[model samples]
Target chain A: MNREIQLIKRPEAAPSHEHLKVVETEQPEPRQGEALVKLLYVSVDPYMRGRMSDAESYIAPFQLNEPMEGGVVAEVVQSKDDSLNQGDIVTAMLPWREYALVKADSVRKVDPSLGPVTTSLGILGMPGLTAYFGLMDIGQPQKGETLVVSGAAGAVGSTVVQIGKIVGCHVVGIAGSDEKTSYLMNELGVDEVINYKKENMADALANACPDGVDVYFDNVGGDISDRVYPLLNKYARIAQCGAIASYNVPNDQGPRMQMHLIKSSALIKGFTVGDYQTRFNEGFNYLSKWLKEGKLTYEETVQEGFETIPDAFFGLFEGKNIGKQLVKVSEPSSN
Target chain B: MNREIQLIKRPEAAPSHEHLKVVETEQPEPRQGEALVKLLYVSVDPYMRGRMSDAESYIAPFQLNEPMEGGVVAEVVQSKDDSLNQGDIVTAMLPWREYALVKADSVRKVDPSLGPVTTSLGILGMPGLTAYFGLMDIGQPQKGETLVVSGAAGAVGSTVVQIGKIVGCHVVGIAGSDEKTSYLMNELGVDEVINYKKENMADALANACPDGVDVYFDNVGGDISDRVYPLLNKYARIAQCGAIASYNVPNDQGPRMQMHLIKSSALIKGFTVGDYQTRFNEGFNYLSKWLKEGKLTYEETVQEGFETIPDAFFGLFEGKNIGKQLVKVSEPSSN
Candidate 1:
């Protein structure tokens, strides 16, 4: 027997348990060119919220009454393809079933020698790649320039702020809680940290960035972004990675930014990790090298059990996770 | 005796006669390394509106009670330097006086052979360069891609739309009136025209761009731009050249665009012509060659008299100009 999480209904605003349902299902069997993967670690991210709504987006909307799918670390219990073997620890975009059948080609074996297999779903995977490209490519942080990261305590943003530091930029991180700010300051060696919940963003940003912001890695776009826009230096670059703030708020309206962009001659580029698919290996190489040299680090907030997957995902919107939020579904078993 | 227009007061809303005043002044003699020039054609543009308010911007704000200055075609009345001679038709950023002394190097000689001397203020000048770089560098319109231009009949936008045609794009022009639409469609050879004042923008844009918008050259940034955001194709590019719609309206609020940008993975770049100062000759060669070959044409709304400059400048916000709006100050004297 196996259990699966399905989208019972599409969310109009913020996602909740009402939109999803946990159901029992028969165990999936591997067919030719496929492998039976038992879920080990389930990754939950803010971007997943966009897939719940049936809007014309970069990716397709999650189908109602079907198991929701996302990045996961799993173990192969049965194999029907030469590429994958039983007991292999792999990672792939898999459906939310406790045990599911996937094409062998879809799942890549995690090299545990580098770190934990869970890193494949995190620092060595989507979030890390997102941070790498969005910062280096779009943000283009130059040495001694001011770099600001919103949602700085989260998965992608935490990685972005660290990269900003590596580039010798005066890095400022904006997070929701004092604990997150402390982690960004003490653990990550960020130049400045602003607890958005405690301080006036405009004043804090002004005090933090004495020289106006040169590079901005925006993850939470709403009032947080609105404050940053006015402080942009001439020829500034903004990597508009994620707008998790507006995902649950429909028809989110704010002060127009066209004037601000023109005043500073700034550029804003919105992108997803998928946009850089061709350069994934290049990103992976740099991330792995940095990890090996101890120049990069990561954090994970793990929630236990398959039943907690929905709650773990819901926690993203509330900023409950300090870093990469994952659910430990089951331990990998030996062949 | 000479006359000059000065910004007496800054407008909180729309600019009008109350904010500007005509003042009498004494004509000055030219010093060594300077030339005395008589204004011929005063170029009135939308960007000038930005200088009226004391805001931190790319260019310095217009000082209160000082003569407002901008691009102008002038006739050198007397020369105290070798670089410029008497009666030479030149163009430069000069004060709004009937006659004024300027540094010889500050004014560039306008070759009369490159169409009319007024072309220095229109198709062969700042507007042309703005259209060139904003479209070519930022918009990156590929052949067969759908390109949309808002405020399509204005100086910068008119040139941009024509350039889109030259680049073999399916160009859609959005303007305020039927006459402007006709100028864009019948005269400029734009594939589609939308009179934003007359039609439902979302529906009109949907009907015009069936393949979706690949490039958006936005000049008017308000509700018109909000409509274009949803229809952007994958990896769309936007040249945010101007926001005339919001220049007069303080704290202009609109639907947040971060989600729209993320949905399509688009890029928006805001710029002024000065940002491409180094490539001026490159832009000029392309524009002049296109003009000589009849590949590009332009329109000018010329208002007579020195006093009419204020009204001409004011008219920009009303969408009164068909193309480049200029105030003819005086005819040039033969050497």
Candidate 2:
């Protein structure tokens, strides 16, 4: 029996496990050019929260009574395609389920020797690509410039800090807690860390970055972003990666940043990894090399069961995730 | 006796004539490398409204009990400088006074034979440069792309529409009234016009731009900007030039647009002409050629008398100006 978490209804606030129900169904058959993937791990991100609500968003909302979908690292249980074979490790977008049958071409083979398959769902996957393109293309951080990132302890934000450091920028991170702040400053080599919870964010930011910020990589938008707005130098670049702060809120009380933007003569752009499909291979190769050299390190807050997916997702909203949040569904298969 | 309007106190709302007092000052002498200019036309823009408040902004706030200063087209009555001669037409940053003395280098000579001296303050001056750079550099309208401009009958907005048309884009305009709408569509050759006062902006935008908006030249940034946000196509660009709608309001409340931006993969950039000073000569030469060739037309709502400077400045907030608003302090010099 294959157990799948079906979305029973749309959510109003932080979605709970009650909003989802585990249902059992007969295993699906793989037709020609298709393969069956037994899920190992599933990635949970703040953007997924947007998909749960039935609203106009970047990606379509998860339909009611349908299994929620996202990036998954799986192993092929059965194959009917020429390219893929049974027992081949692969990555696909088949989420919140124990097993899924999808088009073989839709799945990419993952080399187990490269790193952990779960890393493909984190550092080598969508979040990594998001950080790569957003920083390089949108933020356009120059060497010796000050790069400030909000939500700096999370997956995308942490990645941005490391990348900014690698590119020779003076990186300042703003995270929710002191532990995350220390990790960013000590482990990630970020020049400074502002504990937004305990400190005056604006004053700390101004003090840390005496020369105004050159690149602002935003993940949690609100007062933190509002505080960063006025300190941006002329021609400063802002990459609007995510608004984790406002994602769960039902009303429109986000920060008013228009005046600050105008006064600074800055550029604020919204970007997604999907937009850089043509350059994905380049980014992946670069990040993979950086990972192997130990120049990059990623942290994961792994939840133990498929049942904990909703809880793990909600953890993101409460700033519970230390880094990348993932749900381990099954043990890895040794081929 | 020389009369000038002096800033009496910082204002909280629409600056009434009482905020300014017409006072007599001694006729000033021209220092070395200076020229005495009899003021002809003084320019009034929305940005000046921001200057009236003693708050942190892009430029310094107007000083209390000081003469109000802005772009003025004048005639040099005396010269103590090598660069300028007596009886030369020039444009300078001068007070709202009948006469003034300024360094010769502080003023640029305007050839009335090229176009009207008033044109120096209108199409061939700051407004022209604003439209040129804001549209071309930031908005980047492509041929056949739909360019929608708010405040389309006003100075900067009208120039944006005309320049959009020149760049081979289909231009749609939004104005405050039917007469302004007609002027944009009929006289300015804007492809379509919406009277924002009567029409449902979203419905009108949908009807006018069936293919979706490719570029938005936003001047009035409140409900009109909010209405245009949903109409933007993939990779749309917004040049946030002004927010006249919220300039006078004690508090501004608008819909949060961060999510909408991510959905469209759009860019919103706020800029000033000063930011593009490196390219000013390029923009000036291009606009000057266009103005002389009859490719561009600019209108002015001239409020006669120096005391009307306050009223002329306030007119921008009420959407009363047809084009660039100017204060006529004295008659034009024929010599």
Candidate 3:
């Protein structure tokens, strides 16, 4: 028997055990051009919360009572396709199951020679690409200009602050805890770090961004964003990447921002990494080059066991993860 | 004696009579390069509200006890310069005085052959240029797309809707009254009109735009904008031209829009006409050609006397004007 986690019910607010259920199922078999793989690491992201609801969005909603799917790193146990050999480690968007069958074309072989295979789900994958294009393309940071990143310790934002620094900007990071703030300051070399949980946001932001904010990489949109808007300099740019603050909270309300936008003549563009599909090679080349030169780094908060997937996902809204949050299901069968 | 209006006080909420005061002063002589001009038509605009306050804005605040100034059509009563002759009608940014000395180069000659001298204060001047750049550059209305214009019966918006129609779009106009709606539909040839005061905006918008909103030229930002945000199609663009609804209302609050933007991958750009000053000639050429070809038209809601300028400015918040609101102080001394 194989274990699988299914979406039992759609969430109206914060997701919990009541919305998801773990069940037993028979082992899946591989057909032509398919490979049977065992889950090694499962990626849990904030955007998946949008798919949990039945609302119309950029991506499709998860089917009720069906296995919830997401980015995963797995090891192939049996292969019918010539492209995938036994014990080959691959990453693909797969369902939450201990054992599953995926078409050979759907999964890409992980090049471990570059770095660890897990980097494909974090720094070297979607989150890194999101940070790259969203910051370089939308934010358009310039030397000596101020760049503010909300959720600075999260998967996408952590990379954004580093890129902002590499581009010679006055980088300011806003995070929830002292540990996160310390990491952003000491490790990431951020110009300033505001512990939002302990500091007054408006006063702290004003103190941090005395020259005024020029580029804002917004991941957590709420009162934090409200404070950042009034500080935007003339011709500022905002890369609206994620809004994890509103994902779990129903009917979130705040001060209207249209006037602020008008006063500053700012521009805000909302996008996902998938929107840059054709330019993946361009982004990958830049990111990998930076990583290889020791100019870029990443971190992961991993929970050990498939049963903790729901808890890991739920912790995202609570600001519990330090970086990329993942569930380590099992070690590779052969390495 | 010459009459001038001064900002005596600033209001925390709605602007009223108490904020302005009328004073009498002596008319002065013109210097060597100066011409003494009498005010004929004074333009009253919504953006003036931002200047009424002492807040740091794109333009300077209205100094207390000093005369308020804006775009005006004036007649040269006496000329000490070679550029002007007696009775020449010109347009310039002038103070609220019946007769004042202006440097010859400060004002431009208004060619009456274009339409009328008053057109300089309406369709042929600032309002017309605002409508042209805000819609064409920011909104980017493509053929066969859905273009929605808020404040559709007002000066900038009225022109925006006509341009949308000219671009072969399914144009939807939102206004406050049946009179305004009928004017937008019949006179401007808008494909659909919504009297936001009478109909439920969300339902009406849904019925009017079956395909979804591709471009939104927002002039009145408040509840109307909230309804339009959720219906934005993929890669939509919004020109944040004005927020008349929130200018007087302090501490305005509404539903957050970050999620809607991310879902649609939309872009919102806020700008003023001054931002496009270098390209004014391009905008002017298009507008003049369109007017000459009868593809564009304009309306003016002119109040009598200079004393009514404050009231005309105040009336904008109440949606009392159908199109360009101006105070006709005096007719042209000649012609």
Candidate 4:
């Protein structure tokens, strides 16, 4: 029997452990063209909070009595298809469970030699792809242009700062703590880091970007985004990734953005990483090359044990993790 | 001597007659390379309200104790330049005064053979250029796409509906009254009309467009825009021309927009007609062809006399005009 966390009830405020129930479930067998993957790591993201509610959204809501779905890195224990085999590591959309039986085509075999299989859930995977495409396609940061990114020490934000630097842009990052700010500047090669908790955001941003912000990759919206609004240059592009500030708020009270948009003639666009799945291979190839060249680096805060999955997911809202927050359910098996 | 209304005090709310004071000034002779033009008509637009306040905006605020400036059709009373002769009809940015001493190069000779010089301020001038470039460049409406335009009987909105019809798109106009709605369907060839005052906006929009809206040309951005927000298709574009609904409101009470942008992967862009000065001639030539072919029609609610300029400006906020609102300041003098 395996312990699985199921959504017992929809959440009104910040989703607590009470909203989820840990119950024992019988392990199932893999069907035809399916693989039984022993879950190793499950990712915690801000977008998952939107799915928890019964409100109308881009994606379907998480059902009341079902396990919540998210990105996970797993090891194949058994396979019914010829393409995948036992002991092959892969990434798939599995729930908060110790094991999952997913369709073979739905899972992609992860190349461990490229980097850690855990990085597949962070820098070399969805978060990495989001940063690459969002910045290049939406933000369109040109050479010598100032690129400002909020939530800059997290998985997606860190990747954006690195990619901006690689493209010859002046990258400025906004992080929560001094440690995260130090990590961003020292390891990520970010041009400047603003400790949003300690420093005055408007002053720091204005000082860091003397010319003007040309591309704003927004992850944590609210007052942080409000401060960055007026500093935007004409024809600036804004990539709206996430609104971590308003995720926990029950009512609809985000930032006042109409006046800002009209004032700057800026382009603010919201997009999901799944929308660019057709360009996944291209993103992976470029990201892999950068990782191999030591131009890209990723970090993860892994909470051990399958029972800790709920705590790991809850930790995201509290800003407990430095980079990508993941729950490691099982250990890798030696071939 | 000519009487001109000069800015007396910066307005806080709806501009009254007290904010402007008529002062009699000496009518000077035409200088070298300049022409003295007797004003005929003056354009009154929502954007002028922004200029009335002593606040920083895209365009410079109207200087206190100085004559206001806007698009005007006039005739040259005297000329010192070879390019312009006496009694030649011209169009220039020199309205709100009886007589204007303008540089010869700054004014364009209006051809009365095409249409009335007043049409230049409505269909063939700023409003026309605003609709042309905003629809083609920003909205990018394709055939069979459903376009929803607010303030349907107003200057820019009316032009947008006609242009959408020219591009073979299903155009839906939302206006304040039944008369304006009738004008849009009967004269402008809009496929559907929704009188926001009489009908429920959401239900009316759902009934008018079954497939959902692709392009939302927003001229009045309050409740009308909020109603169209949910019905937008994926990757829909919103040409945010003016916010006539919130123009009179204080700065602290703007419309909410952050959640709307995130839910629909919509693009809301703000633009000024002056930004497209380089492409002005191109837009003028195309709109002129459309006008000559009878594919487009325009209505002007002309308020007679220069003294009625304040009344005409205030009439815009009340939605009193049918199409473009113009104040006739003087009579046209034939050479």
Q: Model 3 clash pairs?
A: none
What residue runs in model 2 are displaced by over 4 Å at the alpha carbon? none
Tens-digit per-residue lDDT, B86-204, candidate 1:
88888999999999998876889999888999888889999999999999999998999999999899999999999999999999999999999999999999999999989998899
RMSD of each: 1.1, 1.7, 1.1, 1.9
Residue B92, model 4: lDDT of 85
Top DockQ model: 3
DockQ order of candidates, best first?
3, 1, 2, 4
Backbone Cα, N, C clashes tallied per candidate: 0, 0, 0, 0
Instruction: Give interface RMSD, every candidate, in order.
Output: 0.6, 1.7, 0.6, 2.6
**lDDT of each residue in B1-335, candidate 2, tens digit only:** 89888889777777777688889998988988888889988998888878889877778888888888899989888889888888888998888888898886688889878787898888888988999999999999999999999989888999999999999998999999988998898889999899999999888999999999999998888888888988778899999898888777766767777776777889999998888889989998999888778888888888888777878887788889888888888876564
Q: How accurate is candidate 2 locally (lDDT)?
A: 0.86
With candidate 3 superimposed using the best TM-score fit, by how many Å does residue A179's alpha carbon deviate from the native? Answer: 0.6
Candidate 1 chain A weakest ten by summed lDDT:
A100-109
The weakest ten consecutive residues by lDDT in model 4 chain B span B251-260
Identify the candidate with maximal lDDT: 1
Candidate structures ordered by lDDT, highest first: 1, 3, 2, 4
Candidate 3 lDDT tens digits, A157-272:
99999999999999999999999999999889999999999999999999999999999999989999999999999999999999988998888999999988999999999999
lDDT by residue (A1-335, candidate 2, tens digit) is: 88888899777877787678788877888888888888888888888888888876667889889888888888888888888877788888875789888786788889877798888888888888899999999998999999999999998888999999999999999999988999899899999999999999878998999999999999988778878887988788999888877786676664456766787888888877899999999999988999999989999989888877878877888898877999988876763
Per-model lDDT = 0.93, 0.86, 0.93, 0.85
Q: Please give the RMSD of candidate 4 to the true structure.
A: 1.9
Better of 1 and 3 by lDDT: 1
In terms of docking quality, how is candidate 1 classified?
Answer: high
